[model samples]
Target: MKVLIAMDSFKGSLSSKQGSEAIAAGIKEVYPSADTKMLPLADGGEGTVEALVEATKGTLFTVPVIGPLQEKIEATYGVLGDHRTVVIEVAAACGLPLIREEQRNPLIATTFGVGELINDAIERGYRDFIIGLGGSATNDGGVGMLQALGFQFQDRHGKEIELGGQSLKDIRRIDAENVSPALSEAQFNVACDVTNPLYGETGAAYIFGPQKGATPEMVEELDQGLRNFARIASEDLGKDIQNPPGAGAAGGLGAAFIGFLQGELKSGIELILESVKMEEQIKGVDIVVTGEGKLDGQTSMGKTASGVAQLAKKMGVPAIALAGSITEEAADLNEIGITSYFSILTKPMTLNEAIDPDTARQNLQVTTAQLFRLIKAFKQ
Candidate 1:
């Protein structure tokens, strides 16, 4: 039998490539002669850089850039095998992980480093860009990033506003003439998975601020700042950025790309799958396995596993999802082409213990071996 193993990262425990190898090992043990293909998958979030880079034989470049808190740090982005297309994830430079739990203040965090990464790429003459917006630690509506790219945000007195989410409220003038002219020569494909608008109840601040260390008062302030920025973007820049689907992604960084760079927002999974040419590889596969660290109802909403299952269904192949934990809500995935779901854990254990690389590999192998045996019995 030919089995295709496509799995997302198990997060802190295992990477997508590691998970696929474990799954493949299990199937191999059950059927020594079985043909297996391993494909690592990600939904254009944290692991997007590694996933696309390896899958496309792309080259990764590291550059020094400012972190979320204005600290200097080394960040990485990739040039796909096509050489013309560059893939970047905002998380590399300004993600939440860069800040400690106590230091997680959205009001002060900035996306300036993200802009530096883009500027570095532009300096190299790369025009086509795939920017993944996720795991942000800021609610600045991307003003800091704009500032880094030569756009100036000033107060009513024409003084340059300081960088940070809180600084958005002081913006009264936006000077884009000094902005990088290279931007006009560029095209950005923004990989986003959420659909929250720019402001209001379900907006960036209200929905994501708490986790970014915002208090109730800060959330209100941040929301107002986003609203103010949106109004200015529409009136001054001639671009309506408010309340657009996905405008709230990455703490309103999505709006910045759409409003300033004229970027096209797309589903994260679709972009990743296309970049890897998954459609061309799914041919002639008997069974396909795909998954992530966790499987829940959200998995059906354009996540890596669901995206793989959708493609497998089109090819008339069954797709199975394996995860560290499978929630009851994951049943929703059944209607979306995932044939079945399984948890790698076989016996009860603490979350930390279960996620260890060695333990995870053993559990996955055992589960896969048993599953294959069941399939053989059914066929016989």
Candidate 2:
């Protein structure tokens, strides 16, 4: 029998590669002769770089860049085996975790580091980019990123605007004269899962500003700033991306990518699947195993496990999910082609204890062995 393991990272427990290896070990215990292939997967978020690097045997690059609060920090991105394609997760530079709860002010958080990472990759001759948009700490409409690319935002007096989301309001002009010339030859594929617009009730500010440490009043101010940015960008850049779906993702970084970089936005999981050529990997596989930190209703909505399951169904292959925690709502996954789902744990345990890497690995092995044994009996 041939089995394909394509599991997402189990959060704090097992990485996608480790999860796949554990399942492979279990399968080997039951069928020593079975052919097992492991393909780690991510939905273009936290584990995207690692997954793509592993899947394509790619190289990882780390560079020093400005953090969300202007602190110097090292950020990492990946270059795939093709060498021309690069994968970047925005959070590596300006994620929420970089700041403390007291320092979680979206008003001044910047995506400058994200732009620095991109610029560094560009300098290395990488023109194709797969940028993940998630876990951002800013709502500056991507102005900080544009700045790093040489797009200057000037005030009414022609003075350059300051960095951060709040600076979007002072923009009187966007001068692209110094923008990186290499951008003209680049292609960007942005992975964004949300559909919020640039500014309004369901827009970046009202929906996400609070989470980035904005109060009710700050949310209002941020929303106004985003609106101003959209207006100026439409007038100066000749593009109106304010109401486009996914424009508000990652604190309006999505809008920045679309409006300024002319990037193509796609569902995170879909982008990941395409980038890694997942369909081609699963061909002739008897079973596909995929999972994540949790199996919930949201998993059906373009999460990694569901994305893999859907593809497996199209190829007439059975797919099963193994998660760190399984929720009642995950039953919705059945309609989306997951044959069934299982939690790795055999007995009840606290969340912290259950998430221990070694414990999770052992649980995964035991559960996978049980699954294989059941399949063997069913074949009889």
Candidate 3:
């Protein structure tokens, strides 16, 4: 029998790759001759660069860039060995973790570091870019990124606007004359899973600003700032991206990608699946084992587990899930064509106890051993 193990990181516990290895060890204990394949997956949030590089053996490039706060920070992005594709995660540059807990302020953060990475890759002669829009610490509507790309946002008097989200309130004229000339021949692809619009009730400010250390009043002000930005962009570019899906992602960096960078937004999971050649890998496999940190209603929403199960079902392969803990309300997964499910632990445990990856891996070994035994006897 052939089994494919594709799982995301088990939260703080094992990485998807480590979890796959643990699963393979357990499976081998029962079926010594079974063929097992591991494909660790990432969802464009955190860990995207590591997953992509590990899977494709890509080369990593490090550079010093301006962080969200215009502070100097060392950032990393990836270049596939194929030489034409450059992979980047915005988190690596100006991510929330780059700032202290007390320093978290969306209105003050920026995506300028992200643009720096893009510019670096462009200078290296790469024409295709895959950027992950997650873990931002800013809400500048990609203004900093625009600044880096040479789309100067000048005040009515022609002075350039200041950095970060707060300055978005400055009314502006946009000048693209200094923008990168190679953009005409390049392609930008944004891999993300959010569906929020650029501004308003479901927009970036109202939904995510709080987590970035905003007070209720700040949320309102940030929302207004984003709205004003939308108006200016529409008037200047003659385009409406106010409600574009994923535009709220990475603090409106999604809109920047669409408007200034001309990038296509794609679901993070779908992009990973395609990146790993999962469609062909799942074919003829007896079982497709996929998982994540938790399984719940959200897991049904194009998550890695759901994406894997749906594709496996299409190819007539049975799919199963193995999660660190089965967050309640996971019943929806049954409706998504997952043939069965498994939680790593057999006994109840606290969230921390259950996810301490070493404990989880040991529990996984025992649980998977039993699962394979049951399947083995049933088949016999």
Q: Highest lDDT: give the candidate number.
A: 2
The 0-to-1 C-alpha lDDT of every candidate, in the order given, reads 0.90, 0.91, 0.85
TM-score of each: 0.95, 0.98, 0.95
Per-residue lDDT of 372 in model 1: 91
For model 3, how many clashes? 0
Record all residue pairs in model 1 with backbone atoms less than 3 Å apart, i.e. clashing.
Answer: none
Deviation in angstroms for 149 in model 3? 1.5
RMSD per prediction, one decimal?
Answer: 1.6, 1.1, 1.6
- lDDT per residue, candidate 3, 1-380, as tens digits? 99998878786788878887888888999999999988888887787777777766789999999997889999999887567788899989889888898989877788888888988989989989888898898888988988887888878789998888887888577778998788767798789889999999999999989888888988888888888888988898875767789999988999888877778999988887787788898987899888887888889886889988989988988888888767668987887878888888879888888878788899878888889999999999
lDDT tens digits, residues 1-380, model 2? 99999989988778899989999999999999999998888998888999889988999999999999989999999999888899999999999988998899888999999999999999999899999998888988888988998999999999999888888888888889998789878899999989999999999999999889999988988999998888888899888879778999999999989888989999999998898888999998999989898999899998999999999999999999999888889998999999989988899899988989999999999999999999999987
Candidate 3 regions exceeding 4 Å error are none
* Candidate 3, residue 272: lDDT: 75
What lDDT, from 0 to 1, does candidate 1 have? 0.90
Candidate 1 accuracy as TM-score: 0.95
How far does residue 13 in candidate 3 sit from its true spot (Å)?
1.9
